[model samples]
Target: MRKSMPEQNTVPTSHEVGSFFRQSETSLFAIILICGGLLAGLAFLDSGQHGLSLVGLGVALGITFMGFQYGFASGWRRFLQIGDGSAVSLHFILAALCALVFIPVTASGLGPSGSLAPVSVSLFVGAFIFGVGMQLANGCGSGVLFSFGGGSGRMIVALPFFVMGSVIGSVILPTFLTFGSLDPIEIGASLDLSGKLGLNLLLLLGAAGLFFWLGRRQGFGLTKRMLGATILIAVLCWAVFMVSRHPWGVTFGFTLWGAKIANLIGLPIEQTTFWNWPGPQRALTHSVLSDTSSLMDFAMIVGAGLWASLSGAFGKADWPDGAQLFAAAIGGLLMGIGARLGFGCNIGAFLAGTASGSMHGWIWFVMAMAGSVLGIRLRARFGF
Candidate 1:
């Protein structure tokens, strides 16, 4: 006689989970595809800076989609059979890969950092503080956006406080600047790469090797359906990154949005340094950051999350108790203070810095990790 298998013992396949969301995510994906096609077509027709090669852009988007989901599963979601370290490990590798390629690109006058040399002190400090804040608030700027979009009540409160903190920090920036030396990192001047293209090619190879090794060691084990979800996220992130000409900075977008609404209502929102203070006298600080694409990107991310939640397919996360809220508010304020002092957030400083080969990014990571550990411990004390 054959042994009978128990129904409950069977694991739910990744395919099933993916199939459930196929209708929702796929429809959204189609919209994205259409919009991307239109944008590329226009860019091609105009022959301007905005007119990037559709094929190249598509490839980059594919890589990004794969990379983000891979990390998300391996790190945050812990979906893969790997431990917690897997996600962060991949992130650092990618960041380093980005820096290797980007440093040379910056040298060639084609990247974001104007003077790209070594990382600056401001960048490191900003990244460190931003990391701590992300852990405290339970998400990065981008994390918050998506979480909120997915119908997180706690994130609703958190997002507002974050904007308010940034605004206040911006207002007090002049006083802070008086105590600092604002200088650019002249990486182009200091770095001595023999050939930019050759270095970039090497970097690309290294990144490919890393992905293959990681995949082999810890297979996604996701069915084709689950893989589709991963792909969708990665593609979205890559497209946003390329179009912005900068790494994704979700917090800035939200902050800018808050400032815009306030200004529209005739509030003295612009009077605050947070919204309109100058940057090192080298740049004018106004509502220039309040743009269409960044804001739309932020909105869409949240919307996607919300759709996930409403369908009851997403996790049921909740708001923190009074103690947790206090910590979040304080953490948000500290993050704002740090971001102002350091000159960016996690996305702008840590991720961008690491990608650009700035030493500051490493320092920020160390400090932020310390902060996260402390915050998590504190949260645990409250029984959260």
Candidate 2:
């Protein structure tokens, strides 16, 4: 594994630009060609700029995520173990920044649709399970993507099962709906733009403040590098919404990927109520490149792969023991299933959900945090 650094958020005092380019020429060229070809192919299809633009944004996302080693799963674990809230505070900061833009832009009808979801029975149960799974697998949706991209053998094994779990969840999602759910509740649905923005800012900043207090021993501020990464992510995620007219999402793409594979294996996915929906049917018929989340997912992988090469950190992780492997498998399944039943993962339901003014986002955070506590307790049993 790559060696750990002493400090993650320190700002440099002077310009010390050493050799930053560590990636090989072959890798650099291959990524360029692949990106260029995808853009060109999109142009050939006469697809709008959204499809092609996502390819670039996706890469940028992967690079930032990998370069910073921003592990949502690990962040929670750190908080539980040592009361370190630096990472958790950073998360709140990111969400607040997004809310500053998202509330206004979406209110004006000039940007993407909100990442809303019903506050439901499934949401509660699903998010809790996902929390436990993320800890066991040691990755969330974005975590697994970059981890696998950086050549983690354990994550590679978990990836396929994640897809399988997504498909299974999708099949049962409608059934879960019948168990009773409330309509999605926006934080300030009745308020005007300025009013909602003010309220959301108050809440989000308050969250950041709470974490800051809990992590007092570690200090409340971010490293200079991490600060930059957080801003870049906020900008890139907003860009995704601007280009696609939909908020950033991760887990559903996994669901779609799984469904396609299931159909091939004679699962009769086409006969399912969820797949037969107009939107899903269109997505199923079209090539994966045409799916916004899928394209971004693929690009994130490439981006992470490129970062690993540049950082010279790829192929450093040793394979896991049998118990860890088993945990990864079960964890993958739980995350996939949780994302489907819960209506999103950390990225989808929590970050984007809160940013887009969905109240379910807060519900997700509470329940998942509880689940994480349990996951931590079970880690020893799993030989983690």
Candidate 3:
């Protein structure tokens, strides 16, 4: 989990933090840490168990993410480099399965909602930019969070800038909405649950078939590692949707974090057009602890870090060269801006949206893939 980087301060590195946490994880500290999150959430939020459930879900996601090392950026990179479609194919399957469950859940009116976003020029440009950034940073939204958990120095560097970019994006997003955007197009919205399920499944099958054909050379079979991880991760995601009444998401939490920080720094964020909206307005006024997505993000980082420590990922703490740090900064900034402009990263837009039967999810996937291709080429020029 440790990587080479240039030193800057006398402070103990995150590697040290990882090591300490790793050691503590086997002790009563682990239980306390988890309980702390649960208790805090329960106490702070009106949703009670539902909010605590999100905390638990976030920890589960972190553990699963690190354990399997399943990631969007790496998966796409491998597909582009070696023509392995296993990961790519598996994601589509995962989304399809989630859709099967989510469509019914939404219809049942149990409180769960889909990750729907408008179809706009911003969405197209943002997804593509996010793709490029993920490749440059070597992680997507989930990838960055878990990678940080696993004691990655480069990720630590990228994270703050990513936050900065998200804040900036949020400020500019309302303008993007003016650029030929269409209202969110929910697939089969007028249909019954059964109709939605069939239509969604049919569409998923078509997409999966296309992927399989395109990468048939290496085939689409997952390795034992990936298969096990996928099963566990998929189940966890389902549980999260059931409890949270929303599909899994990550980027919005970062954006919220940025927004909060901006408020602290005296930015007139609350007055901005985007923030003035009811949803953003509420978010701006609430504690981070009360926000489901933000809480999840926090838990995931802690979970990944403890896991990384156990894996001995913090044994070494080498600082990256200036060039590498510079690259990471640029990557983080782009990803942050892109995520906000695009409505989400892979997890939020592609996985959650598609699962919730939103057409924008499919659009995000196509554009992001194209962006990944460009990212790969840029990677060569940057000597990555």
Candidate 4:
């Protein structure tokens, strides 16, 4: 029999904290230490080969920092419960921190190579669908991976379905593209920053002010632990933006896993973009999204999940009933399709978009929230 909530709380004294840590998904501090050290070592060894691509360096920093931030957030549940606004406040603080760093870097137009690529309307539409999918799944792509790591049995089922959906999505993406749903955002035309620092300065100040004002209005105060976590995540976000050549992503893992699974099953899955056929051998070839760094993302989620599960921070399995299961499956499918269509997920759209100053991010966020609300309503009505 499961212990009652009251019973569990009353019997906690000597080994409570230790036990909780043990049950948590993964040790953020440990991940920070390990990953940070690895990246640092790489930076040390290849000072000449790669100048520690600031964006890549930033991403590494962001991942570890976010682990700490989430750890702190989850630890202070009592404080967080004090006000719903508290969560908003923390996001504001984190967002502001990210915007300040990322905006300036992008505006500066300094990087290893590659000209600036514009954010597009397609990105916005994709983002909106992605957001809606996150709410429906009751977690973002990254959240699902961690939830599974933390022993979320329901998420475990959802993950595979998510991959399948992505494969299906890849097959049908051509149709969507033909229908004109997948267009890119034009940056060069819309932006008016010509003078050296004109646009960059405006964006930097705008991002900082916007997040700060939002935070103030939302009452973004924090306990020491949460403060520490926030700082860690802020730094990490900065690093990710500087490194990964794009943004922090979580769905790529699902995409790759899905591709691999399909190939194994002889389902004619793309060895590259999840849309092509693999004949004779399922040999993985070089594409922008399937390289070492892509695999690194896969490892991070698995690693984080492992850490969370061992720490006793794992939530209950809470398997969805038949109806809820159906919802979950469909939701996961939408998420996969939407994420691919948008070229990202919650982390990709909202988190990355907000940090990058793309207006599409904001649009996707609103639509996704709306979709989530609808999903919740549907779930409730059906008792799922």
Residue-wise C-alpha lDDT for candidate 4, range 95-183, written one tens digit per residue: 55665666556666786111122244444455555545554555567666655544455566667777877666666554455544423
Tens-digit lDDT track for model 1 on 169-228? 556655555555445443233436644434433543464455446655665332455445
The reply for model 1, stretches above 4 Å from the true place, is 1-83, 110-129, 186-189, 194-241, 264-267, 272-293, 300-303, 306-326
lDDT of each: 0.49, 0.82, 0.81, 0.52
Better of 1 and 4 by lDDT: 4
**Candidate 4 ranges beyond 4 A from true positions:** 1-89, 107-128, 181-227, 271-293, 314-323, 382-384
Residues forming the 10-long window of minimal summed lDDT in candidate 3: 312-321
Better of 2 and 3 by lDDT: 2
Q: Which candidate ranks first by TM-score, i.e. highest?
A: 2
* Candidate 3 local lDDT, 1-384, one digit each (tens): 999798787755556655565565455346636755664555346567667777777888887898788799988888888887777877887898788778887888778877788999999999999999898888999999998776677788889989998988898999988888999999998988888889998988677666666677776555677767877888888898877778888988898999998889898888899899987789889877677778889888867766665665555434455566677788899999999899999999999888888888999998998999988888765567
Model 3, residue 60: distance off in Å is 0.6
Q: How many collisions per candidate?
A: 12, 2, 10, 33
Error of 1 at 101 (Å): 4.7
Candidate order by decreasing lDDT: 2, 3, 4, 1
If candidate 3 were superposed on the true structure by all CA atoms, what would the RMSD be?
A: 5.1
My TM-score estimates for the predictions, one after another, are: 0.62, 0.89, 0.88, 0.64
Model 3 clash pairs are 4-319, 4-320, 5-318, 5-319, 5-320, 6-319, 6-320, 112-245, 149-304, 149-305
Selected candidate, larger TM-score, 3 vs 4: 3
Cand. 2 Cα-lDDT: 0.82
